[model samples]
Every structure is written in C-alpha cells, then in structure tokens.
Target: MEGRQLQQVLNTQRLKSLQEWMQESSITLTQVNGQRKYGGPPPGWQGPVPGPGCEVFISQIPRDVYEDRLIPLFQSIGTIYEFRLMMNFSGQNRGFAYAKYGDPLTASTAVMTLHHYRLPEGGCLTVRKSTEKRQLRLGDLPTSINQLELLTVLRMLSDGVEEVLLKMAGPKGREVVALVNYSSHYAASMAKKVLAQAFKKHYGISITVKWTSFSKSKHVSETGQEDGTFTPPGLSPLPKPSITPPHLHPKPSLQDVPAHPPLQSFFRAVGSPAGLPRDEMKPQGPVNRDAVSLLQWMCEVNRLGTPRYEVRFHHASSDGFLCFSYEVLIPCFLIPLYGVIQILPGPSVQATKEEVYRAVAELVIQTICKVSNARPF
Candidate 1:
C-alpha cells in the first residue's frame, strides 16, 4: 500500500513538471512573436536602428563637380530626391553639396558607403546626415526685372538651374524677389554673388540676395500661384553684328547647263580629246555565283542550317589561283568548334575544292556536338 502511494506521488510530480514546462514554452513563443508587435527589431538583425532625415551633407567636394557628375555617384545606391551643390556669389563651387534620398535607409546607406570616399577630381568626400535645413533665395532685385532678364542673370550666374520663382512685391512688378533652384547648393551660392554684381553694374542698385529655407521656396512652387505670372523667355538672343558684310557669290547650278547636251557630254566637250584610262572607266566584275553555289551545297549536305553568310572569290592572275574568304554566323554555343576544321594544302600547295568541303563537314559536325552539349548559364 505504501509503495502504491509513493508511485502515485511520483506520477503527480511528473505530471506537474510536464505542465510547467509546456507553460514556459508557450510563454517563450509568445514573447518571441510579440517582438514586432511592440516595434522591436526582427529576428537575426545586426545593424544600427535606421535614423531619421533623408538629407545627407557632403563636404570637401571638388570645385569642378557639377550636378551631372555628382548625382550619379549617390544615385547608384538609392533614389535621389534632391541634389544641390553649394556655390559662392562669383559662380564658383564652394566644394560642398547636399543630397536628399527618398528614404532615411537609403540616406544612411549612402552616408556609410560614401563617407570619406575619394572623388575623381581630387577630393575626399565628407558625407554625413544633414542637421540643418538649406534655403535658396535671391532677394532685393530691381523691381523692373522681367522673367527674361532674371533668367539671363541666372544663366550668367551659374549652371544646373532647376527652377526659378520670381515674386513681384512692389507695384508695376519692379521689385522682384527671385527664387532660384539649382541642382546643387554650390550653384546657388555662386549665382548669388554674380547676380548681385551684375545687377549693380546693369541697374546701378545694390541688389539684396538672401538664401532662405528650401521649404519656403518649395511651398511657393507647389502652390502654383506665381508660376504663370511671367513666362520666362527662351535663351537671350545673340547680339547683332556691328557691320554688314558683302554678299556671297551664288553657286553654279546643274540646271543652268545648255539643253543641247547632257552634263556628262558638256564636261567631255570641255575636257581633253582623250578620255579617262580604260581601267579607270571599267566596272567591277560580277561575283562568281558558281563558287557561292558550291559552298552553299556543301553547307546543306553537312546539315549546317541556313546561316547568314557572305562568300567572295577573287581570281588574281591568269594561272587560275582562286582565293576566297567567307563569313558565317555561328551560334555562341558552337564557338568551341571555331578552329576544328581549317583547310590547308597537304605540303605547300593551295587547298583543293574536295579538301575544303571535307574540312567544312568536319567543322559542322564538331559544332553540332558542341552545341548539343552546351548548357545555359
């Protein structure tokens, strides 16, 4: 009876242990699956948590690096939302730029991969997440400046002009606040200085230039209220020449020739009595169709399919020593059989017709075998 009691006690303990283990296992599984529910990292993750902001600041840019050359480098890593080179008022690159990626992950990737990367033109890039926002504005312009004049000034200021916004503050649209968007901040900075100088020289007023936040300019563009105010004209027309030049002589025309004889006869009538040499006037002979037919027959007999090819035979001397060259399309898979069959004389003489045919047949068979064995990559 005691032994039966002990066995029962042992059975209960075993059951209790099993239940506890199952409960613990269930809790472990729940904890693991609930990780994402609380916005935790996924399983097997091994990297820094992605940061905010898609804009990256790039410093130490080469002076010659323009938008066309700069965008491609970062674009290879991810989609580029914005590329801007920082420039000075003199239309010179300030050796820095900003690139905004479509996502923070992409921006992070570009920073990690390209930071301290050496540029082709001679500078190592200093790439990092941008903390400060950039704004590009050209303020305090002559109110009378039209869109055409603004464009002209901007063009002379720098290249890579993406968008131009002109806000007329005063009456008669005389005081213009020009918002210029360049591919790079470098370009914008350069335009500011040059434009100020140009405005002072052209209009005799000290133009005020300001670099505002990008958000302000972007908002003005997206609203579309000022877009149609002034349609910027095409490139400024070239300046006219100072002096008029003499008229050029008209070229002689074939239609003006006399109707009695054709142009060829007219030329002959005016030339020496003796005509061109016989060799010079003679036309080339027709291709030897017989040789082509023979080669085609051989190819067909050898089970070589109808491949696009050209064959030409030349008979140099009266000795009937014929030399021929041919080109045929061979599938890439059969390239291994390229030199399998080459026609050659037994000792030193030229290859005979039969020998050439035999060689071609052997080449075709080898090519077929190679193609049959080839496997797609």
Candidate 2:
C-alpha cells in the first residue's frame, strides 16, 4: 500500500476505537452548531472540526488601546472574523483580548511570523491559542447539589475532568458558579454540547456558555493588613511574595488524606507477631490451620454480596502485593458483635514484621461493624 493509504487506514482505526470507547461509557458525540469549517479534521476521519484560525488570547495590554487598535495589528496577517476586548465591573479593560481569524493556515502563519516581535520598540505583545475553547458560567446552582454531586454529573458526560471550581457568585444566601474542567479540548467541546440539556432538566438552572479564557475566571484574593503588608487570609500581617517558593501553589489535593503509609515505616511497625501458645506452636489450634484458611475464605466470599461493608485494597510494600483486610470495630458506636464473629487467627503478612499487631486487630473489628450497619450510602 502507498504511504498515504496506510496513514488513512491508521486514522480510520483510531477514530473507530475512540467512538467505541465513548459508546461503552454512554457518551454520544454529535455535531456542534455554528461550527465553522476553516480546517479539516485533525488529519483523519470526518468529524466536528476546529477552524483554521487559532483562538489568540492576549493579556496585559493598555486599556486605552481598544478593539479598533487591535484589528489592524491582527488583520495584517489574515481576515479577522471576530475580535473582543473583555471589560470588568468598573467599565475598565481587564487587560485581556481574544481574536479569531478566518483561515487556519493564515492564522498559523501569523502566529509563527509575528510572536514576540516588539511592536515598534517598548511595546510588548504576547500571543497564543486559548487552552479553554468555551465554558459554562453556571449560576443559581441549587445549594442542595454539593460539590461531589455536581462532579458526578460532569464525569458522566465527559471522559475525565481535571478540576471543578465552585464559588458563590451572588449574595450570601443564593447563587453560585461552577467552572468545570475537562481533560482535553475535545472532551471540553463534547461537554459544552451535552451540558445544557442535562443541567436544565436535572437542576432547573440554565447556564451561560461562552468561549472565554479559563485564567480570567480563576479569582484569588490576597489580603493585606493595616500594617501595609499582604498575607494569606486570617493571618494578621502579610508576607513578601519574594520569600515564597516559586513552585508553591494552592492545590486541592494538599488537603486530602493518603490511604497508605510508606512501606519502610509500615514494615518497621509490624516487625513480628506474638508467639503462639505452646499447644498451638505446631500451627494448629482446636481451630486447625485449615480452619483458619476456611474462615478467611468465608470472609472473602461474604464480601462480594455484603451491602454494609466498604472494601478497599492497598499496598504497603514495593513488591506487587496487596493488603487484604477488613475493619471490625465501630469507633463511633462501641457495639459488640452478637452473632458468630469469625476471622483467621494470625497477623497479616501484608504488614511489615515490625508493625503493631493490635492495630491490625482493631482494623479487622472496625471493618465488620461498618460493613454490617444499615447506614447511608
């Protein structure tokens, strides 16, 4: 086969795989309305395409220079289709602008030819395509729908999302805006299509969607003190930004609790188990070694249909081995077990030899109680 034929075959296979994956996951990708055809699909099968002119998002420009001033600079290279200068509450320029050109080839050429070329001396121009194609400015979100519920709805529509920003957009008692983050441009594009239908029906709230820069929607307030210094909120006096680490940024996961401890520490804590009684030293109790095995099998079998039990797997070691354990004790409610409470009699090998056996015992007890309770899902 010719090289171009082989490439075409490969592209067709890739698109087929993507469509299959979407169908299995219950996502349907349809054509978008008002989608201008500036360029063909990304070197392959026919589908919704992005226009040739890249969305050039600019920032840090003087307010005095409005849309009229920018058009000539941009149109010099290509036919400018749309130009917008964003404004803030005070009717002042937000120091940002967006320009969409008519032709993708011309847009690409312009981006390559005119970047960072100082505009007649001291003036500077920073240009690049916008990362976010479009976003829904969700408002009046029902307070009943918390963060998790909203995220679940979005995940059902897209492949996977990076982050979801929820904030109060109105007065204290009502209204909020959620900035949904998708994994890629295609996923965002797909999400923008499906969200309006899903949201209105489920939440009774209609959101406004627009092609805007995500950076502009991200708001962070740095507080300053009476002493004339800036600080984090709740801190009396602020500190200098220069002293802060360049890599330091507010990440939501910083607040998340890790499920497992380091392997070395875990092993060091479970170094050895208590010596069995003299009679049981032979690795057999009235409940023989086989009984221990049978009891463990039952726990595993019962877990499959158990409603109350929350089962999770973890690794405390570098070796590809898992720690299979269940909690027994109910920390909040110290209710003793009434029925036949069965368990394997020995320390779990998953833990390090130096670990405390009693903690493992406690965990087993907690697991049973929690899993058995008729509680909220």
Q: Among these predicted structures, which one has the highest TM-score?
A: 2
Native-to-model Cα distance after best TM-score fit, residue 201 in candidate 1, in Å: 3.3
Q: Which stretches of candidate 2 lie over 4 Å from their true place?
A: 1-32, 36-110, 114-128, 131-135, 202-377
Q: Candidate 1 on 1-377: residue-level lDDT in tens?
A: 97676555343443454346546534121111101011112233223222237778777766555444566688798766556555443333456666766678898899999999997667898888764322245666544444433543343344434345567654554556766655433334444446565545433556676655432242212121111112223222222111111111221222322223332232232232266643342212211123323333333333443333333343334554445454444323353233323343333222243344344434444455565673111
The CA lDDT of each predicted structure is 0.44, 0.39
After superposition of all CA atoms, the RMSD between model 2 and the true structure is: 22.7
TM-score for candidate 2? 0.28
Q: Any idea what lDDT model 1 has?
A: 0.44
Task: State in Å the error of residue 81, model 1.
Answer: 15
TM-score of each: 0.27, 0.28
Clash statistics: count for each candidate: 20, 27
Worst lDDT run of 10 residues, candidate 2, spans 220-229
